[model samples]
Target: MAATEGPTVAQSSPSSTPLPPGMVLGPDGKPCRTCTDWKSWSKLAKTKKAQTQQGGSGSESAGASSSSSAGSAAAAAVVTAGAGTDDTAVNATAPDDCPPDREVLGRATWTFLHTMAAYYPEKPNEREQTMMKSLLSSFSQFYPCGHCAEHLRDEMKKEPPKVASRMELAWWMCGMHNKVNTMLGKDEFDCNKLDERWRDGPSDGRCD
Candidate 1:
């Protein structure tokens, strides 16, 4: 969800606040905890805690220092929630019945998208195709990560969803997902494996 390159919007400029590396600022110029992974959020929380305990008047960042107490509390809650367990366990473990981090949310979202594409009617009518396009348009507008949503919208404009048939839709989804993977420097999934990954069991029938 976090923009690996930079802020997503033109309106968002660098804040006076000294945010942790890779922390994303939302449109409001506030730190978007949901945008970045938990590690960055933990760094912010620790910095605030150190300042608070020392009672020092540290240099305040634009949005971070203003809401330090509330933001730090929220970050601390996420960390302490998994207390009595291994300290290393807390990182990237927000999906176990807690609010999901960006990675968890992204994976769950892609799963739903690909599954839906796999199950789309093989020979959908005009109405069905229109409905599918509409659904995707709306999804791009309101995804949890604002920057991610913006990027998807841009991609959609470049190559609109192809919902004419099940195969087309599935391949389109795969291409979109691969674009994201490339952006994040991850390996591209083999499109030939779409059915095995989303719809049918593998040739060996392990899933079955």
Candidate 2:
């Protein structure tokens, strides 16, 4: 549903803290943590804190030291939140009940989409088909990540949703998911496993 273009650095005014390069901003032009990976967000926060402290203090070196200490402490907390030092890591399991990051949001949205596809009627009536198309259009318009929503809209124009049948919808979703995965440099999932993964469970009966 979403794709990534590589990140570029943000420019800031002299008086303001410089955000980390590659930090994505929301529609309001403020830093968007949910739109960014955990590593980038953490770096941006630490940089901003350090810059603020430096501006406030008499001794520049002392301010730097204090900033480093504070940054380290905050990072430690994140580590405890189950995010290791990986650049793509997200605090999905954070103890403080933090909001979902981009990756977490993607996973949840994909789950919903796949499950919906799995249960779709084999022969949807015209009204049901119309409703499904409307739902997808609305979803594309209102998805939380603006860029992601835009990407989905563009992709939809290129290849509209195939919602005529259950299997048709399921394969379409798998193809879309693979497109996203390819953009993110991830391995493509096997579309053949769709029912096994989403509806039928494994042949091994482990999920049963």
* Candidate closest to the true structure, highest TM-score: 2
RMSD of 1: 7.7
* Residue 174 in model 2: lDDT: 94
Candidate 2 stretches greater than 4 Å from native: 6-15, 59-96
Model 2: per-residue Cα lDDT at residue 30: 76
lDDT of 1 by residue, 50-99 (tens): 54543333236545555665554455444434331335743545537666
Minimal lDDT window, size 10, model 1: 9-18
Which pairs clash (backbone N, Cα, C closer than 3 Å) in model 1? 17-61, 17-62
Error of 1 at 49 (Å): 2.0
Q: What TM-score does each of the candidates earn? A: 0.76, 0.78
Best-matching candidate per lDDT:
2
1-208 per-residue lDDT for model 2 (tens digits): 4865423335442334555445677777777766776665666555555445544552547647766656654544444332334545543233346677677788889999999999999999999899999999999999887778888888889999999999999999999889999988899999999999999999999998
Error of 2 at 25 (Å): 1.8
Instruction: Please give the lDDT score at residue 94 for candidate 1.
Output: 51
